[model samples]
Target: MKGPLFYAKILLFGEYGIIKDSKGLAIPYNSYQGALKMSENPSDVAKKSNQNLLKYYKYLSDLKTDLVHFRLDELKRDIDGGMYFDSSIPQGYGVGSSGALVASIYDKYADDKITVLENLTRDKLLNLKHIFSLMESFFHGKSSGLDPLNSYLSLPILINSKDHVEPTGIPSQKQGKGAVFLLDSEITGETEPMVNIFMNKMKNEGFRRMLNEDFAKYTDACIDDFLHGNVKSLFGNVKNLSKVVLSNFKPMIPMAFHQIWQQGIETNAYYLKLCGSGGGGYILGFTEDYEKAKDLLKNYKLELVYRF
Candidate 1:
């Protein structure tokens, strides 16, 4: 028995900004996905996944939350019967691997689950985010729950603040020169360490001020520009956002890519930002021309996400 697939997600804007109640936008990335399955003859990988699920089941059983409840007994029964998560999403790549797992588990085992077909009012979306936050905490020491929520809904979600979230529509994709892409740092990032760094940084008065005055402001503007299909304005705000990230959030970026990140801004060919926590996963890039950006960064691997 196999459950439906859950896709990976990209937090297009508002990475660290959302923690402070700034606006955020997340979209489903269909390039990689995962689902739960019961194998007749399990391989070593499948067995390992089953073992992890066993631990997760225990965690969920002890989890105290009024947002959502799971069918823990049935989940345990399935695990004993050789159930495991068979997935293609890369782990520690900032692309929502654990989130897809969380989403799949909720879909298959949650009692009174919120189906995607339902009317998903604002309150319901908030409830789902709250539930996902609890479930995903087992993986990430702290979680905003946006990744799992995006995977579960399979829709673009606009986060007005921590408590206000709802599904939103992005402008139609165009096969044009301007585009959003991902650069492969080829180094895996651990979410815990990266998040810890951010938390530590948050303790600084200077850092907190910068986050409020600069980071959140630029991120919110970028979200508005993208959703409204304002390409010219979007690129300008992204440029400023890229500069702010490079100057202030240096620790989150991989050491090797610092020069490239700046080069994009200096050259105006592209602008680089944190894809997720950003210690060393994929760096998100925005460019007015994909071909020119590709040529400039020929040494690194690039994957086009959306065209504008």
Candidate 2:
């Protein structure tokens, strides 16, 4: 059986800041997507996937009483028929693999949940975020729910405040030399431990100061410049953002890229930051000259995301 499709997401700005109510922007990335389907194949991976879905289903079912409710019968029917996610999105790469699955489940199973076709108002969007947060917490231990929310809606969401968010527009791509890219870590990353490190770091007064001043400053600017299509300013802010991430979020950086991350700051060839929680996964990169950046990072796999 075919189910609703969920897209991958990118948190173009506000990785950690959004937790503190800093300005944030997330866009649906269609390059990777997932959907639920019934499979007759009984491969080990398929069996594991099915088992994972059963766990998530149980989690959702248990939380349905006070949170968003789903049509359990329909979900069970599909599950019994070997329903599993057929997706290209890589797991543990910070690209929303699990988030897409969570979104698809909610879209297909949730009764009276917000529909994508409905005119999404502030209240509905907030409710959706809340429900998706509870639903996704089963995976992440704790969740902001923005990833799954973005996956489900397939729209650009701008976080104005903790309680305020709405659909936003980003500048269309152009054939400029500057670009954003993803660097593969060749290993999977987990989200919870990385998040724990960030939380612990927040306990430091100095970290908090830098977060409020330097980190927030650049994060806010990046969001503004990106939304306004101010490419030049976006690059400048992204540079600072990259620097801050490198210095402060060191543990998140893959050891192999540590030198490259510093080299970019020193030489201004490219800026690198975490794509997600960032123990392994993918590291996001920004560079004014894609060719030069590619050459400098030649040893690693790079995927072009956008051009300035």
Find the candidate with the highest lDDT and give its number. Answer: 1
How well is each residue in 117-193 modelled by candidate 1, as lDDT tens digits? Answer: 98988888888898999999999998988999999999999999999998999999998999999999999999998
Q: Assess candidate 2 and give its TM-score to the true structure.
A: 0.97
Off by over 4 Å in 1: none
lDDT of 2 by residue, 243-272 (tens): 899889999887888898899999989988
Best by TM-score: 1
True-structure RMSD, every candidate: 0.9, 1.2
RMSD from true fold, candidate 2: 1.2
Give per-candidate clash totals: 0, 0
lDDT of each: 0.93, 0.87
TM-score of each: 0.98, 0.97
